[model samples]
Target: MKSDMAQEEDEPSGAVLDQPQEISFRRALLDRISPLISSTYTLRPFPSKWQVIRHKLEQLRSYLAAAGDSPSDSQLMELLQSVTYTAAEAQALASRCADESYTGGKLLLRSNLDVVSAKLDFHLKRLEEFYAAGILTLARAIVVSRPPAGASREDMRFYVKDLVSRVKIGDSQLRLRALGALNEALLEDEKYARILSMEVANGVASLVTLLESESRDVQEEAARAVDSVARFDSHKAALVTAGAVAPLIRLLEKPGTSMEAKERAARALKKLTENSDNAWSVSAHGGVPTLLSICSEESGTSELVHAACGVLRSLSGVEEIKRYMVEKGAVVVFVKLAGAREEAAQVQGIELLLRVACDDEQSTAVREGVLRALVRVLDTGSPKAKEMALRAIENLCAASPSVAMLDHLVVSGFLDRALLLLRGGEVCVQEAVLKAVSRLGGMSEVVKKAMGDSGFIPELVRLLEVRSLQVREMAAETLAGMISVHKNRKRFVKEEENLNRLLRLLNPEEKSATKKFLVAALVILTDSTSVRRRIAASGYINHLEKLAETDVTDAKKVIKKLSSANRFRSLLTGIWNS
Candidate 1:
């Protein structure tokens, strides 16, 4: 009969005899004892089947302990699978599994308790191994990880203190590693950078000390860290206070320094100079000569050239630094870099050149090569480069001391390019081009004729209605400059739109200088009798008469010119009669 039952159990559909008779009989006995197990405990009710399953598991455990052997893996899994446990139940089971004395006792079972204990031990060991492996992997990941996103301020402060302490002590190798980590942390978020800048006491000074280290690796990493931290304007003062300027300059001047260190130091200096006060500080520490040397160095790397140009550009905004750079022959070096193959070097070099060229004392220092570079930048450079180049050209042309440079620009198709940019460029470009045209127009009648013939009059008339007040004012000034020539006056009078746009500027809200230019342009345009009649009919004569009461001398002059013109008086008399 037992052999027959075993054969039945092997059949696919034999659910009734799927397990050995002893195991099935044991489960049936537990099923009967399940309610008794639940009644013995005082707690809230569990699901009906869950109560029975828990009781059965408990009874099984007791039976295993009484027998002193371990159950098979499949048997244990099958018993536990009878019902799902809640989170609370799982926690309780985990706690129970953690106990080393959890041996079954005082219950009957088919299997030996010793086998059950060994099997449980094997499964528990596997679980503990997995848990430990996960923990170790997580720790390794955290050790190398950047701060979590949106890390709290306290967390950032702690991170800064830890890294700063590490950077302050230990062997050179360890400190270098710490600085690398610190730089990584600072670059991870702008918030963390701010925390490092403000929270950690003497943090910046510590990094500054590392800038003078004998180890190149240490110096480079320290520079990179300062560069990252210096991005925030608030920290720049701290860096300067820490005496970083002299060491950074030394890095730039040191012949043996690697290109990477030089480049990073230059960039850090550039960031520090974002504040105007820090800029003067950099110059005071002899940074100008160092930076100019970097720019002039033939063997300098492209990055070093670019960064040095950037720092010089910032410093050039200060009048004292401008004179210093010019005295050190920075103009010639900048002119060379403005034409470099690297676009960053070209852009920054051009900007630096522009700032230097703004001073009248530097005009004689600017050579023909520099003019050609400005023309080249204006012709093919980026929009920003073009804007800056046009500004430099305007400054050169407008400076009383740079008449020779102005003549060179006019003869080299510079005015023609200015007209093109004025026609199709952005508003800023248009403003710059107008300033250049105005300056070049004043240079000589030949250039004025060239500007008038470039169809510049109509473009200037269109700009009068542009939204930007500066463009409108510059356009007015440029037109006034051109209208001194008879042909430009005729052209200005021919555009009724231009006449009306000028009439609109008679509103009291227009600035005094803009009003002056508009009035000057109108006075010249009214030399034509027809335009005078149109201006009179537009009632702008009355507007000009009212403006004459103000401190505007040009307004008074325009009133005198309009009143002296017979055609304008007749048109006004006719309009008054009508």
Candidate 2:
């Protein structure tokens, strides 16, 4: 009775005569149809293809999860294979959809594909607007995974040439994508960048046009691409000649631009201004005032401030631009940035101010404020920052009016930090520190005393043996300056090692300037009875007498002083008799 009832039910439903067989037939039909749905479904227009394909993938994932034991391993592999192929196709379509000439069919089919490609680009941008993070991630992953190894020089040139052409005529969305691709390729490898810069004709001109795009993404990406290409000195003049300066200045001046965009534009301007002609072009396009405005923008970001300061630092090398920057309150902005928490801004700001202070006309205007800012940087900034700070200090101290500011530097621990740097800082930092010390030590008694109290004498003495001739010369000159003060002379003469180092530098092979300072320092040290006796006993008088025969007036004077010193008269006569 049960078998008859089951057969009745199955016969009504299908050819199967049993429930299990009926279920098996339905599963087989589903397995065969799943691939078709996953592969050939193009129901939606190109604009909505991504969404339709995404939905198809999600359905496939769900069907795989629900399959349990119904579908064979082969069927599962086939379904997954279709999903993989479709995903690859979707990615390829997204990238190529922006290509207006991409046609995948015969005459009629080609027309249809072109229309679909245009629609796809339009809708892809819209989709990106809604799901920007996801799309960007996918795009970045695709771009990063594809290395530029297979891209020959000609291929890169053509690629950039095509993109530049598209950038001119394509929609805003396409232009942005093309510019973005250009930027990516430029950044990926220096070879591609060099090829684009040297081989492609309109690459830079198109980037300049993209810099003026209303889209900030296009503007920022274009500026960054310009920055990368400008790294090659060969391309700098080309970039500047392509009208990059005017738009870059405009982007920097535009209030509505993002800080990142302004930052990139400022960096590009900095690079462009590396050529003097480009600097003149920038000034002609009102770049200095715009950069000054950015420097003074209180709400500007650290990156923006840093980039602006860098541009100003470069432009300030031009005397005319420098005077303009100073007249426009560049000093005030630099003072503020030098004290900011941003290390890069602090470094660049100090560097720009240093340039300004190097000019005789502008040095007085920023001397006091620059001194204070440099002290702050030397206290808490990085090694590079410290080096810049010390250089600025040296420049500021070069002005006669800034002499009184030495006490402020000393009170702020400038002497202490400088001494520490001389001992263990980087080579650049050490050189800067030595310069600052030498300049300040020559200016005032208070600075000399502070330096002496900081144990700088020993450090200076040790520097006499340093490998750099400049360092050795600076050390000797500083010592001569210190001993000019009577109190410092007493202190220096009391240190046996200091006197020994000074005498050692009197070797005939030593530099003439070094020998002159050494002689001057020894002249003061010999004012002490004990130092006079020590020098007479050491027989350095013979070397000093030989040096006196030359044009070294100080050496001649020292010989007379040593011969006349009552404490050394008998020892000197005994040596002369021998």
Number of the top-ranking candidate, with TM-score as the measure: 2
- Model 1 lDDT tens row, 1-578: 56853554444531333234434543554454444334324323233333333333342333322221222233333332332122224334323333423446313211233333344444334423422333101111113234588876645655565566456533576677678888888787877677666655567888899888999999999989888878888778778888988899888888778788889999999888877777887888888888888887779888888778778877887888788888888878888777676667777787777677756565453655567789988777777778878777766566543456656766777877887887788888888788777877787777788787778888887877778889988988888888899877777777677788787778766554577788877767766668766876886676777788876677777666667786656788999999
Q: How many residue pairs clash (N, CA or C atoms closer than 3 angstroms) in each of the candidate models, in the order given?
A: 13, 0
Q: Which stretches of candidate 2 lie over 4 Å from their true place?
A: 1-159, 184-206, 232-242, 253-260, 284-286, 289-305, 363-365, 399-431, 440-477, 493-520, 527-530, 534-578
46-158 per-residue lDDT for model 2 (tens digits):
54444444333333322222222221222223333344444445545544544533566335443544554444344334323322322111111112122467765444544
Give Cα-based local distance difference scores for all models. 0.67, 0.66
Instruction: Candidate 2: give the clashing pairs.
Output: none
RMSD after CA superposition, every candidate:
19.2, 15.2
Q: How does residue 564 of candidate 2 score in lDDT?
A: 77
TM-score per candidate, chains pooled: 0.54, 0.57
